[model samples]
Target: MEVSYREEGVASAASSVAGRLVADGVPARLAGGDPTLWGEDAEAEAAVRLGWLTLPRSSRELLPALGELAARTRAAGLTNVVLAGMGGSSLAAEIICATGDVPLTVLDTTDPGQVRRALTDRLESTVVVVASKSGSTVETDCHLRIYQRLFADAGLDPAGRVVVVTDPGSPLEQLAADGGHELVLAPPDVGGRYSALSAFGLVPAALAGADVAGLLDEAAEVLPLLSLDTGNPGLDLGAALGGAALAGRDKLLLEDQLSPIFGLPDWIEQLVAESTGKQGRGILPVVGADPNRSGDELVVAIESDVGDVRVDGPLGAQFLVWEYATAVAGLLLEVDPFDQPQVAESKENTTALLALPDLPTGAPAFTDGPVEVYGAATAKDLPGLFAELLHAIPGDGYLAIMAYLDRLAAFDAPVPEGADFEQMTDAWMMADPLTLRTLLALRTDRPVTFGWGPRFLHSTGQYHKGGPQNGVFLQITGVVTEDVAVPGRPYSLGRLQLAQALGDLAALETRGRPAVRLHLTDRAAGVARLLAAAQEA
Candidate 1:
């Protein structure tokens, strides 16, 4: 049961890297040795090296793919872009779309209804980009099926309308070739989550109309700047943080506005968790824009101002810098900086859920009078529409509950349900416990609605961050007042700061989880500005 480096040669190499860091005044430590925990094997070491080495070359090559994607998207007369993938495959794209004012939708959820709705409703003619490193991920496969169904329904050629990005030899590559779909290849050496600079990120960036070439160029330029021996920021930062972790500090915190960068945090989590967690002891890496220290030891903040600014794009740069720094920091701690065990558990849970039978359906009838629409000018004077369905025949309760439960469950499951057929009334009631009173207030078949701000912020935000890592967050912010003038003194500034703090906390709470934000200026405007901004930069 002794915890020590299993391979003398690998240990020696790691020690060499640690020695270089120490010589340059950076702290460095080692992690491994537990017979029970899976330590670094030869493959892990090679993967780490390959991850680092491919950065420069991948950046150079990804530029052309991005340019071509942009050209193709424009040529197809498409305005909206939909990215379908899960885990590392989709996180980077989600991050980029969230940062800019790009009209893009990302389907990271495995929930069947959510995916079906995205494809049938919002993504009808939109160009769909499917990204997966292994090409065999269940969630990605499910999404591809939905796309195919939607394409068939619309009478469109699925192959011509779809694009696939993956490793050259992956099953997805073969599928793309067989289907005659446009294909983008990730470097053979690059892992999925780490392939942000590869085709995984570049295609999405192109769809968002971002300067993908600039992003890659910026990343490539930083490769030479990272050195294990020199006091290079990347190396030194990694060493200091990793060393601190080995010295009994387990938590790493990232602070930034664009939350999507937490995708990199997810990437870091896998890196640190799998690499260090091998031995009897390991560091717990948590990614958040707002650091909430419950009992965490090491707190490393990527100074928002420093590093390569031009290359990172608005939000992408911030994430790239943080991701690079995190890797370097792990090196300083002398831990193998890549590996993830929790992923297997996630997949296992998803598979189990997918095999379960669909829930029953039943909808309760609404009996209450008209709903009091607050902020509405007409109010009670408007048509007395039944806000709740209390008198109508109850819809299939089992199906509705099943659907609702499926949505909530997928927040925690790796493979989500494809369809939710539960009664809408019963499903709404089950989804939110607080909605009981609201449900009692409505009548007829009208949808039971919840207040946007106060209720969602107070009730859902808790589970969004504090609950199990399975919840998905959708933050809706409306600018109805047009920068409403606030009294200067203590209240205005205090409220603004508080609002920012809460937003930051929400962002942090859902870090590495499924989340999206819709910021709209006017409530009257039909279109709510929706983007997957949760993990942007």
Candidate 2:
């Protein structure tokens, strides 16, 4: 199987990198194909073969470490497990513990409140596992510092309590040695995001009581199955998908349930988005719970468990099958199935924002005067209350009005230049709609900016802290029953706690900045009322 190199320069660079990897004893291979050849390429087939061959064969080597940690957790009686890291380093552990029925809490966000809540809300006997290949991820470091302070405040020993995972001679390993903490070294050459199947992800998965061994074995079996040929399911799928995407079909949809494959979609998103998104063309990868309905394009589902035969018969199968499908899709695109360009920028931006002392101010505030009231009460007479607020704030008072859910996407707009006011507003709008509306109401007639969402919030959350601040913040909170729970664990209240902490952090972000807190009993109804009031205002 072979892929043609398009731009000679790019091909040369790729070859140089591949050659270096080979010199370093890494099994490096180049898959190439012509961009104009549509679907005719051996690169896709090669990718499929390689992907299958690369799967881990066993998790037995990690079992001992996992057992030790689990025993420590049980012995120490820790109730919360904070896995600190970013990208693949953090995502794997988070997804496993968050999706599993574990008796511990997993905090994934970089928000101060998230760290605070993880430290303060749970029992003092919480255990922290800091995972990072480089050990210098700013967010992970910030979180480690926060945890250190909490440990100090609690008067607990840091050594033997916290675990640091990284390369053998990496700074993280050095820190762990100096701090007297347990150290788990990832393979030397393993990248941070790709280290999950290694000790990087194993420790947390085992601690969370997931079938880590099973997962690894499953992955190992998959490795040999992927080859750079149309006959290889993985490569074929990748090629077909990539071809479709290049052919102007920009949306790649993964059914629900398969969403928790953890970093899989993200991996694909980075691959497709970065590889194909250049030159004025890119696919918009979207993964979500398939509204249980389908139309137009083809649908394929893979099973999550092992020995699940992947039959392209029906539209949906299981998680493993879906992974195979992802591999195939990558082949079709003739691009490396891994790597993310914006990830480093994301970390850099977050670190820079954290280091900045002058947090943006002067944007609108939610309230002009002191707001002393705080309650978890649901609003009554929604329509009537909205009418009252509308009457209180008259004509053209609202520049933009969006529902709490809808406001999440408002920040998708590029930040304007020079106008600090617009930049801050965009940030606030993207952060929380409740905050944006309150600010708009307080400042009356300042062109409001915002968007709506369920997915938008996740996209813009990183930008809210990393980007320039330009707007007011109002965090909306409400109690909602658990609609879904990971099997076999304690009640899945972690999400609620996570949401509350996220909102709290957003509120605490600025001092003397306009912000409001509206606690509702019926979240859906409250959001409706908030939207109605915004429209009326």
User: What total of clashing residue pairs does each candidate reach?
Assistant: 42, 58
TM-score of each: 0.57, 0.55
The C-alpha stretches of model 1 lying farther than 4 A from their native spots are: 1-40, 43-49, 122-124, 258-281, 287-295, 304-335, 349-537
After TM-score superposition, the amount by which residue 262's alpha carbon in candidate 2 deviates from its true location, in angstroms, is 8.4
lDDT of 1 by residue, 82-159 (tens): 887755566566656555546667766533334444655645457788888878765566567767766777788887
TM-score of 2: 0.55
RMSD of each: 17.4, 14.8
Model 2 C-alpha lDDT versus the unseen true structure: 0.44
Top model by TM-score, which number?
Answer: 1
lDDT of each: 0.44, 0.44
Q: For residues 363-445, could you state the per-residue lDDT of candidate 2 as single tens digits?
A: 22232121111322122333333333333332312122212232222344446567598677855444444453453344343
Root-mean-square deviation of Cα positions for candidate 2 versus the true structure, in angstroms: 14.8
